[model samples]
Target chain A: MIWGSILGITFVVALIILYEWPKLKQGSKKEKATVVVLTGAGWLLAVLLVFFPEMPGPTDVIKAIFQPLGRYMEK
Target chain B: MIEKGRISAFQMAIMMYLVVVGTGIIFIPGITAKYAKQDMWLSPILASLAGILAVCTAFQLHKLYPKQTLIEYSVNVIGKIPGKVLGLIFLFFYIRMNAGGIRIYADFVAGSFFTETPLIVIISTMILVCAFAVHGGIEVVGRTSQFFIPLYVLFLLIIIILLLPDLDFKNLFPVMGNGLMPSIKGAITPQSWFAEFLLTAFLLPFLKDVNKGRKWGLISVFAIMFTFVVTNLVILFLMGSITASFTYPLLTASRYISIADFLQHLESIVMAIWVAGTFVKFSVVYYAIVLSTAQLLGLSNYRPLVFPLGFLTMLFSIWGVANETESSSYNSTIFPFFSLVVQTLIPLLLLLVAFLRKKSGRRKPN
Candidate 1:
């Protein structure tokens, strides 16, 4: 099941790259690098999430940082 | 420069209206009712001050740096490293912010209607559609918003007008029975929604009629404020004290519309409003994110970054939000403060610094 999810993620990432890579070929090297880096980062995060779904996420950090102010809204 | 397409201030206004009112009307009435009770309708009026302030700050900053988005001008206002850091902070804030929005949208769909559909499917489908809009740039987004506003407004009024018979005017009594504090407290949540007007900082640079930006922005704020006031009153009149009990009071209120049992199940109108408004909202924010990311990275083109960022947003929406309760708690509690600091306070500070620096520069030349 986990491998299936990973494969699914990989397939989607591949399709995005495949569809865009041809267009990126005409753009600057920097733009192409950015596309690779961003998609690669997303792919890594997806795989990591598949493995460790319990890992803390951005909302957790935001909640922690803002909890002091957020407390007033709590019932 | 990255965005070749230009939108008018009126289009910008329409987009901003949807951005605030899209999910806001659905989620906010219940939350505001929790505090404001009978005075929930008043919260949006008071909260609109934040929208005005945000528009003013963004407009003033645009006057100083007329050609650049917030990400680019922050560098000019605050020096390179700090400005870049600020840009990244904004980028992070927006990405997470849009994620929460899309999540709220998915949760609404899945929880209220599509009980059997997978959340990932809903989230991804919405993201995919928004990606096309963002990929089309500001022109596409602006035109789409222009096309949809009338329909959106019509559907909204249809629900309210249909519910007129069921409304009880007495629910508005004891208007301030608990005094203004409860309404003020309720205003806090909606204030964050209003603070989202700071997003105009991005669209302002791409505007064709830059001079009309502030006027249209204020008009948009007033429109959203009016919409919220009307919806809140309608919900308040219909449900009164029990308004906070339902997760989506407006949705429930719309579900109540039954004229001769023929105009029944009008909640689909609410669903239409949600889906369409959220698409524009997400596309606008999504465009901002992609454009700013390209600027921050000094890329020549933003198009390639669109899909990747959309993918990231999808992942982020599903990231920390384990369930509807957690997401709502975050929205009501943490999100308001977080949004205020990032969206409202930070831009105001940047504007002040930009003005001071410009003054000192003029004095040095003299």
Candidate 2:
């Protein structure tokens, strides 16, 4: 199931690049680089999530930071 | 201008209304009821003040720098490096916040209706639709939201009307029996929802009727407050103190409508409005994220970044929390304070800094 999901994730990423690549040709080098970097990062994160589903995310960080105040709401 | 599309202030108003009321209607009544109890209706009125303050801050910032969005003007308000850092913080905050919003939508759908479907499917499909809207630019989002508002309003009214016969007016009694503090505490959650009006900072720079921006924004806030109050009252009347026990109180209220057995199962209407409203909400936030990212990275166009950002948003929503309980608790507690800081406090400070800078610059001429 995990392998199948990874394959699905890769396929979606490839399709996104394929659809967007033609449009980026008219854009600047910086535009192309940013898109490539963002897409690659998304792909990496999705794969990492598939493997380490227990990874602490942005919400965990936020919850940690706001724990003191959040405790007040528990009442 | 990264986006060449222009929307009227009225369109901006409609878009913001849907953005706030979309997921808000479903989630807010229950959450507010948890704290405010019988005084839940008062919470939205209190919350509107935050909305008003957010709109005023965004508008004042717009007046100071008419041509730029919050992301662009932050660099001008502060210095280059710090402004860019602030801009990045705004971008990250928006992305995370939007992801949380989408997660709420997905969880509602999955938990209530599509029990068998995978959440990723639900999240991705919604993101895909929103990406297309964002890809079309600000005008498309504005017009699409405008197109959907009447239907959204009509269906909502239909549910409210259908449920009218069942409401127990006695539930409103002992108003503020706890002496206003519980409702004020309840206002904390919805206040954060209202503070989302600061997103107008992104839309204001693209308005055709710029002078009407603040007027229409306040109108939007009033409209949202009215929606929340009405929904909160309806749920309170229908379910009383039990409102908070259910996850989506309004959904439960609509589900309770079985007038003569023919008008039953109208939760589908609730579901329709939920999906439509959330689409607009996500698109607006998604558009903000992509536009700010392009500006932050100095890209010439924002279109290519849309899909990539959509993917990231989906991932963020999935990774937002482990389950529904965590998401709900976060929404009611930490998310409000986080939203207050980023959306309200930070922008107000930025505006004050910009004013002082202008004053000192004028003194330099002496």
Candidate 3:
């Protein structure tokens, strides 16, 4: 059920992007197709990051550096 | 005036207040509780005094050059090269601050409500929205803040009122238990946030009624101080000693609100309101950084630098501190001195130089 909803939302978002891209590209020649593809890829990554829930990359690094402060306050 | 936009002193004041009070209301109570314990509310009063001193410095500089921004007048006050260097430093600080705010808000949302959402998505979406607002220029940003400040205040009042049932006034008693030093130390972090009012030096020149600038500035400071006091008292009353343990005391307080089960999980609502305020705050700081950079570089337009700098800001925010703990430590230990030097001392020096220059008849090329 959750995966279905996620996929449905992604499809709708892609359709909206497709509808908006041409209008947004009317004045610019900076690879409209490329920008659209990249944006779609970004949305996909966002969805994966949400669903996968990895061990934490950037956030954990931050937490590790500040662990001393946290420990100090805990004391 | 170099800029075409004109905001009323009232709008300018509200914008300043929104910027200063943004994320502080959420996280500060926790940090204050950690150090000051029951005396957390008093820290804001001290912080506000520091804010007032910083504002005076900014105002003096503004008075010296009535219609120029800090970027423009710094050149007149401290020679061209040094002025540009100082402007760049200010620009970098504002950019980093804005990015950090974005990250913090993103982290808050991810931790509290949208547990499934990626932090980068939350951060990027908010920054993109702020970038769009920044593209609209100062007038749009000012008007948006005017619209949100009242809503933010109303939400805060509602939260305070709801938590009234949970509040134990006794929790705030035995003030200054560890003597004045801890509270004063707690005040340092907020004073840095308050010293951000010096950004008003950029916005004041664009105010329609410059004479009302001082009144509005002071009002903004009071509003911010009131916000901090209310937030601290509520957190202290409700959470007591454990207040320091939570990452966001205000959010925790909202979560503690359980009126017949229907009002139980209003954390999402609070998050929405906070995100709105953070939006305005981010836009203001980002806009100031871009404007100052453009002015310093003698650019014909600031529009081009906006997106590039936004990207850099996002990167720097991610790289700025190792974690929330480091961020909080920086906020508490070092930020006060940082703010005092950048927002207070430099502006005072500029004001003095401008005053001396005027006395020597070096006023502008006229």
Candidate 4:
């Protein structure tokens, strides 16, 4: 499972880089920066969520934050 | 100038129908029945007004800026910084909600069809397919929906007609037996759904004939309402109160199609067609986020943002909820109100501001 997941993710990462690298190189600095930041954050989130799913995720955090409000609304 | 593709008002209307019916058709009967029971059909009848309201608000805004999306025109009404802040909020909200939507699709597919497959596979594959369509931009998305919607309706009608033998029309009786309040409760969630026509604001600018945009938009709203009413009636007739028992009442109802025990369990065909609608549904959501983000950030093009946003969407979908109970609970309790504010209330407020700005602009010119 781990090997397959890693291989699949690696393939995806390669594809994205291959498609994006030239565009990034040719883009103005602001466009290049925007792509870099968004892509980097996306990769980080995907890796963390994919490899260690049991770790408390956004829904868990949001559910906790909204739990009190949700209870109040439910009432 | 950001989007080069041009689509007709009719294509926009079809896209609206797909967006409106995407998840609502499959999941609404159970949810509405939970609140309205036998009178579930009435909820859509009344709830359609909100959809009309949403489309009207979108049209008025489109009138003010026939060439701009909500994100782009928002700046022309407000100052640069606040406009950008609004744009940022819109981007995050869409990405989050769309992630939750994608999660719902994954949950349904995983729960019913592919128990052995990892939820991520179903989730990512759907997102990838939608991303591919979204990458083609609005024209491709519009044409794809125009192509698929007829086939989708045909299959849906097939399921409805095949189950006619099993339908108990009396199950829908004791008309409003529970009073109008429960129907109102059912209408509440659907009203939020109707408000989702706010998405049409994004498509309006790219329309070839802005003059007919409102007519087609309203037509699409009525079409959605008609589809909902028919679906709820079909579910009530077929499953009776047992409509609330299954997580996916439409899918369950389709499984009941038995002609000489030969045509039993048409779940595969139903699911395939449903995935088509959902594909168009999520594609629009993805397009809204990517295009809006690019516009907000002053980028000349939006393609670079597509997969990054798609990746973010998959993560949120994975992390959105634990199971069906959580998803439905969120939908019933908090999501309706949230959608009302985001899709209806906020847009209405923006329209007001734009109105004031228009009046002031005329004054200055005088």
* Candidate 1 local lDDT, residue A37: 92
lDDT by residue (B1-366, candidate 1, tens digit) is: 677898999999999999999889778998999989999999999999999999999999999998898999999999999999999999999999899999889999999999999999999999999999988889999999999999999998888888888889999998799889999999999999999999999999888889999999999999999999999998998998899899999899888888887878999878987899999999999999999999999988889999999999999988878889998998999999998999998999999999999999989976
Considering every candidate listed, which one attains the maximal lDDT?
1
Whole-model lDDT, candidate 4? 0.83
| Residue B183 error, candidate 4, Å | 1.1
List per-candidate RMSD values in Å: 0.8, 0.9, 6.6, 2.2
Task: Give lDDT: candidate 1, residue B331.
Answer: 90
Model 3 chain A lDDT-worst window of ten: A27-36
Worst 10 residues of 1 chain B by lDDT: B254-263
What is the per-residue lDDT of model 2 for residues B27-119, given as tens digits with 9 covering 90 to 100? 888889989899999999999999999999999999999979999999998999999999998998999889889989989999999999999
Order of the predicted models by DockQ, top scorer first: 1, 2, 4, 3
TM-score of chain A of 2: 0.95
Per-residue error for B182 in candidate 4, Å, reads: 0.9
Task: Give one digit per residue, the lDDT tens place, for model 4 in B188-219.
Answer: 77887788788888989999998898899999
DockQ leader:
1
Question: Which residue ranges in model 2 land beyond 4 Å of their true spot?
Answer: none
For each candidate, what's the DockQ?
Answer: 0.87, 0.78, 0.06, 0.44
Model 1 spans with C-alpha error above 4 angstroms: none
For model 3, residues B1-366, the per-residue Cα lDDT tens digits are 336888999998888887887877766777777778889999999989867876677777788888888889888888889988888778766766676677777777777778898666787678778878887889999999988987888888888899998788788778887799888767767877888888888898888998888888898899899989978888898988888788788887888899988877777778878888889999989889878876876755555445556655655565536556656665555455656667777777777778888877755566
What's the residue-level lDDT of B345 in candidate 1?
Answer: 89
TM-score for each model: 0.99, 0.99, 0.82, 0.94
- What DockQ results for candidate 4? 0.44
